[model samples]
Target: MMKTRVCACQTKDVYLPERARVVASEPMTATERFLAFELESGRPLGHQPGQFVEVSVPGVGEAPISISSSPTRGAAFEMVVRKVGNVSRAMHELKPGDPVGIRGPFGTSFPVGGAMKGQDVLFVCGGIGLVPVRSAIQYVLDHRKDYGHATILFGTRTPAERLFVAEAAEWARAPRATYMETVDRGDGQWTGSVGVITTLLPKVTIQPAKTVAVICGPPIMYKFVILELRRMGLSDDRMYVSLERHMKCGVGKCGHCQINGLYVCQDGPVFRFADVAQIREAI
Candidate 1:
């Protein structure tokens, strides 16, 4: 167990975790919770959209979690965690003012501030996949004028499993933005579209030339979603994907996330679809 957390961190030391304080922790669903943390060093996390951080607890261990808030949000960073393992279970036990360990803010990020600016931005997310894509959504919305028409498409397995309900609704209502949500299975409370996320794609229109698509979800979702995007005329070069499933150790030393010449933790967790299209395991 950690006696006292480290207040500062060195990027050169890949094994160390910088101490951060929990500013807020709240439940988003039965199994998932929202956590916001502020670095004890009083500096911003400096993460771009679609990046992730490796988190730890005193007696438990470490897990890589996607950064759910945009870098434009503020000094603090946020994550929506599902209680599934020792570290995540311990993270659920944290409260306001408690200390936590954070490593990384690793991996590549969405091109919202770079190649994506001035072009139409399209975001496609599924279930908990929204946890990472939300950062780019927040960044795009925060600077809505920097891009063209913004379109967001989200789908979950069920109604109760929906994360960021209120915020997603707000995104739907934003000026110059279009938001649509669906669930594979819906309950009485779920009044939106009912089907896989691809069903909603046909109902919308986009500019194939100017639009940039950013996707995140399970590997299977990536396959089908890209199929529909391809049918819709979006090219692989204009698309980006988040493969957070392959994350491990938050560094290249661990080959758990390696695919041939690519290391998901180091080279990317977010990659241009064209760059990794030929790698069978990249999705």
Candidate 2:
């Protein structure tokens, strides 16, 4: 695998954005929209998985959205936006061929190499948490022969709420991949496991010492899931998590995304469990 380059130092203003045209937009769920774009500059968005970009709408303002597609996928980048506020609501109104301002592919990313090299990988995602986690998952899949066993455990509130249904189906069928899914509750048509994601852990075979796990979800879910991971004999250093917080600025200048001494926008959206454990209030 080629080494992913860190972005070049910007001599010009970083706040200024380049023009980008929306190439596709579709509904992923009632609240979420999947959007793809390509820069007018014709440059590849060389972003690593777990990083995010600050998307702007001129008048509607900008918000940091995680890049959902792997950099290895294509020249176009993707984002999954949930309509919860003005900026995201405006984003929901966007369509193919529309133009928008693009700021950055900022922040830290998952350690797909070095520390994680040659280890069994277990991806644990909850709800929309899969959005960012999907990037890293795809990177692993793209270079399938480079890694060991890969197991994915995804959970949602209900069956209909599942995201990337088609892609997940394909991953389930991929060679050397173990995919399992669960829901907190099931509708009449549901036939899969019906329970919280933690319940699925006991059903999978994992080597706690040789495995590296990445988890992303709501704060409440993180607490319980991490507890279960601990119970499974996984050490804190071997586990990683992606965190979410209010991030007014994509860089560390703004304090909104601060978690104790770390900035989620700069230091991490992804962090090792050993470091986060030092902050009592962090999940």
Candidate 3:
């Protein structure tokens, strides 16, 4: 039997937040805000797609936000923050030119490098899961020549609740890309497919043996999606899932993000299903 090897993470005072300036802020939904920020000195956040950064609102506190924009895009990074609590509420109140604190570009990232070149890629994002998957999708789109066929599946509760409304349309029409979107429930104005995100899987044309599936969403969504992927003959090693938690500290010190013995904040916010499947706490 082959042993599973976990990546080593170097620890430091990863809690120290860097000063950043909000260059743009737009409301994506009633509870979510789209924010673009750059470091004080204009240094790139240097984060890979699927990694997360801690954004602080002065005394209000800090919260982990997935880097939504791909580094291949530009110097600045973006985050789609949902206003679920006090810290997020403060983040939503931020405007262009406002100052904020940022710590880390932490956690494991989706492998879009050499290993993924020329391979079919399928991204399954549910609701807010699209926030992080957007980065990976953009990276592939920008370097389209380096990969094989690429597909993106997005599911939300309604048309009004969708994120990246404009980009989603563009991707749907882009060459070599397959973009499908569905809503669990539709409104009078909604005309697209209506069903759970997993249902969209049947519409995708993928070579299971050559595809790498990246799945993220509410925990419950993972099970159904994985079941479908398995039915398609994809192995656990070929599938990756992002598991976000209350990582109180970006460094592994705070046990808040631990599942059994592994720290989700350090070992992953992104993990290959094969490694996570054995852990009882992991979905």
lDDT of each: 0.89, 0.90, 0.90
TM-score of every prediction relative to native: 0.94, 0.95, 0.94
Error of 1 at 64 (Å): 0.8
Q: Is candidate 1 or candidate 2 better by TM-score?
A: 2
* lDDT winner: 3
Task: Assess candidate 2 and give its lDDT.
Answer: 0.90
What is the TM-score of candidate 3?
0.94
Model 1 residue 158 CA deviation (Å) reads 0.7
> How many clashing residue pairs appear in each of the predictions shown?
0, 0, 0
Ranking by TM-score: 2, 3, 1
Clashing pairs in 1: none
Q: Write the per-residue lDDT of candidate 3 for residues 11-89, one digit (tens) a residue.
A: 4445678899999999998888999999998889899999998889998988888999999988889989898889888
**Model 1, range 139-239, lDDT digits (tens) per residue?**
99999889998899999888888889899889989999999989998898777899998998998898999999999987789999998999999999999
Clashing pairs in 3: none
All candidates: CA RMSD (Å): 5.3, 5.4, 5.1
lDDT rank, highest first? 3, 2, 1
